[model samples]
Target: MKKEKTVTMGVDERYSQWKSMVGVLYDWLANHNLVWPSLSCRWGPLLEQATYKNRHRLYLSEQTDGSVPNTLVVANVEVVKPRVAAAEHISQFNEEARSPFVKKYKTIIHPGEVNRIRELPQNSKIVATHTDIPEVYIWDLETQPNRQALLGAATSRPDLVLTGHDDIAEYALAMCPTEPFVLSGGKDKYVVLWSVQDHISSLAAEAGSNVKMGSKNSQKATESPSVGPRGIFQGHTDTVEDVQFCTSSALEFCSVGDDSCLIFWDARVGSLPAAKVDKVHDGDIHCVDWNPHDINFILTGSADNTVKMFDRRKLSSEGVGSPVYKFEGHEAAILSVQWCPDKSSVFGSSAEDGYLNIWDHEKVGETSGSGGPKGANAPPGLLFRHAGHRDKVVDFHWNPSEPWTIVSVSDDCDSTNGGGTLQVWRMIDLIYRPENEVLAELDSYRTQILGTTP
Candidate 1:
């Protein structure tokens, strides 16, 4: 108990220190308090772009206390542009108070606790959700009527259901970037795939209409459509933890699992894995992502407290695969790993240690003097550490529309007076910009401040 208390105190101190440096470290930040913990978070489409700020749709889940049904929340978030927020006022936020920047737009009373949410890249309003069930639920956000989340509310029916898994598939979910395809991994030790090509036109038509689809009390709300898996790949000896489709190809995808294996699948060939890497990690692999810009590079985070980067060209079906680089920065098991949308060489990893670390693989062997974190013992390529969350950062997503922006959620209900913390932040450009460029900018600023001609 004493040791645990000490650890908690240390975390509090680090968070306090980070809070003090927020004005200097972040260009923009919004801390919104959530009423319940969210296991997953994903940014939807940008709704509007104004001069000072942009309005975006945000998707998140509310794990409720059973007094009210769990829900998938659609929220509108106003993101302040760079240099628009006053530095001194940016850090002045109350932990328990909700930010004015976020407003609830719609609520879907989900059938169960939503474990994961993934928006289709082709149409952001189309989403796939996983629960403590074998099937995956699909929703058309534009057509779904907004419902008030109250006690004893009827569960919102999904527009479509993807059924295949024989056991609960709680977390692993992904949507194809090139097509309206969905993929999920389950405790049944199987990876399931489904394509919504047949329903896309109907959904698009419904979204364009002014009529709302259904109400909570409507029993004749048209029979919900259901689809079967196009392919069910089996290779993992244990539960598959996460999955991701290749950015450019809907036919190719990959999955990581508790079996410590990484399996790549090619739907064009067959359901069996085209290439399998046995024992890719020392522990259960929790997350995996294929680089969008460089399709050859893939990243996986594991229970071994490491994130490994692998080149697809080197992986084969024959032997244990070798990672090009192993990032050992997190103190606890990593839960999420995602490549930055704007930077091919950069990525972020979040873990149970209450930290989200940003890394640039291009800076592995360079000596300090770069703008990244500097220490003799610092892990290779670590650029910055975000210590905002008081507990585990379960999930985070990089904003593709906004450079260097991120939305991260933490399951810190126990520490923060019965709720979780959702933060949207972007580090100052000086942190990630080229060293020479930063120096030149600093010199220009100094010349202006001193009232001297440069």
Candidate 2:
């Protein structure tokens, strides 16, 4: 299938975003009374909706000084005071000021999945978050006519929901692009196929709505999406760390786990794996991603401290047991690998090494005997590194719609240190600027707190 491409951002557009995000972070930290031991943060919807704007922010903050606290606070930076974050992150606030009933969607530490879904006549946004508990909460993040409602909707009961998996917690979830299905993998060694339409309808019924949102034949425009576990996949003997749908097929998906194997699955053929590769890596496979362009090309990062590429088309070809391409670069176990959603040529990896590196699949040259990459494996596809976090980079995402904008979340390293785990970053090259917006927002809020301080 021929793919349609769009114009990538020029240096000017990237520069402008770099200025906006950096200034926002500096201002946020320099002035606010952020809660200590901060857990998670993310970009929020704009308080004032523009006709069709392209940027967003708001967050949870750690204190400016080195002190760490145990409580969590959801601040909505858009409304001047701290606004609430999504449900799980905002459970403890007072009822009067409570944003939405997001409490029901509580989740623990896991990669946050924000996706741009186009189920209707136009595109919208939804964030799928996993918790330590069994469920994954799918909150409708943005609705077309009203963008300010994003925060409110995120806190309300999720638009779609799934619960079984019981005791085993889910670690990864990937939504299929062309269907109403989502794949979930977890510690239980089970992969579930959930129907978004069923989940949404469940919510609608609970609210006592007799309204028939759309015709039974229509796939979109429903009051609540279905949450049915339409299918179940089982094969791995250990914890399933990650699962991703094949870019080329709607029914086919791949799952990797602690069992040291990678299994390619196809729903059409039932629960059995279409292709199975045992001992795929030396250790537990932590993450897996299908190349945006080459559906047969799969990328896997592992506790073995190596990143390996597998080609299903060549599974029965030469080096049947070995990877098509294995690149070793990280000193620590690689936790995440993301093939840029916008540019098929580039991909990024993050790990315990506290660095995020970008690579080009086509330009990568020869590797050492141990399957590790040497210097300058490729060029201009923008092979580079960002050493911006002090702690391990848990997860990172290349904004689906914007190739240049990147966001990463990690564990905290303490406030005095100038780095972040819960942070936003860009691949664009821009000079760092000074901070003064705190004067307009947080500083004013704080000054009001310590009025006329000596």
Candidate 3:
């Protein structure tokens, strides 16, 4: 007994000594202003010689995510600036289009800079952003500045406004498919639809024709646009998570929430939901999106680690029939799910597991060279995956005009803010590359660097 106790004490002492030494080293590093390097991060490369040294070798790829691309880097930028007048065609596409339009920017974000305003274009005038608090900000890359707008609650308390949400809780926001209305859901358990055109027209009416685009004096003329609520649909018993307009009609929309229910609302109807189902899932519904091609079809991601497809006609406030299709391969919460804008059978899901998984509901499974799927209904096998994020994926969307392109954002490791990046990735590269080929390429890259596969 004595011998054993002595041995345990020696081991504990050694561990304590090692821990203390490590703490000392850590403190020393902190004192010297050192930080461990991260795998990757989003950065905009500047073309100006003064912006970043050694610029000739590589152009800062537009908004490239912090991923080691197979060959090159590309990035995209979401600039926060005042609106400009509707103008001639200014395409924001690949590098070819960037050269002509991006050159007009006065202040260019640099490598060492965060989202700070380092400079502005020569002709640009700064606009004040005091009273114009926005709840949700959306920028249409295709039309960009022309369609850029803000959304906020009409009845707001300055003390209660959160950065991205109004009131106590924010559930969802969706743009109308064919109309000028925007729908928003909240912890208040009400879905409100606001007319976009009305907000703009009312703002213009207030400006009294004195507002000039990009003019210094225009800030006073175009104060906060009154975004009074248009129509309110009330039915949910819990917090709303997502709300989306049905693709086929402007009069219809859908919402989901922590109540483990989904409700369909009609803008033209009463406060009651047009359709509702509280038994679709065993957990909170995190997101819901209508199929772009099918009005009856909608896809939902839930906290139960599953994605369910519902046929709206078969569901009501009472109950629902068997789902049209169900997917259950995610090991963590399904945070975001989106149907491919082009393909009816194809779609994608982003989860807390840090993977972007693609699926085709019509296909039972797919066989890779590794082997066939272990089960007939094993979630159709991942068509491809993007596991580059280091944390939970918060949301994602397919580029409005680009079918094969997608963008995903996630929660940061600290959970203090978002993934802190707006990354762009190509679905084609992930879908087409065979497993073996991808492995070989990754292995080659590792060997070329460290002389061993990582």
Clashes of each: 0, 22, 9
- Candidate 2 lDDT (Cα, 0 to 1): 0.54
For candidate 1, write residues 365-420 as lDDT tens digits: 87652323345456789888888899999999999898999999999866665679
Q: Which ten residues in a row have the lowest lDDT in candidate 1?
A: 210-219
- Per-candidate TM equals 0.94, 0.62, 0.58
lDDT of each: 0.89, 0.54, 0.50
Clashes of 1: 0
lDDT for model 3: 0.50
Per-residue lDDT tens digits for candidate 2, residues 1-454, read 1221121223234334433343322211111212222333433433343343233333332322323221112233222112212222222232123222111122211122221111210222444555555666555443212212222233233455566564555466777766666788788888877766675465467656643333232224343343557788889898888888877676989999999888888899898777788899999998999886878788899999888888787775322556877876676899888887766766888887766677666556524111012234423232655555545666675644433556565544432234333444443222111135534454667757778653
The per-residue C-alpha lDDT of model 2 at residue 102 equals: 16
Question: Where is model 1 more than 4 Å wrong at Cα?
Answer: 200-222, 369-377, 448-454
Q: What is the lDDT of residue 434 in candidate 1?
A: 83
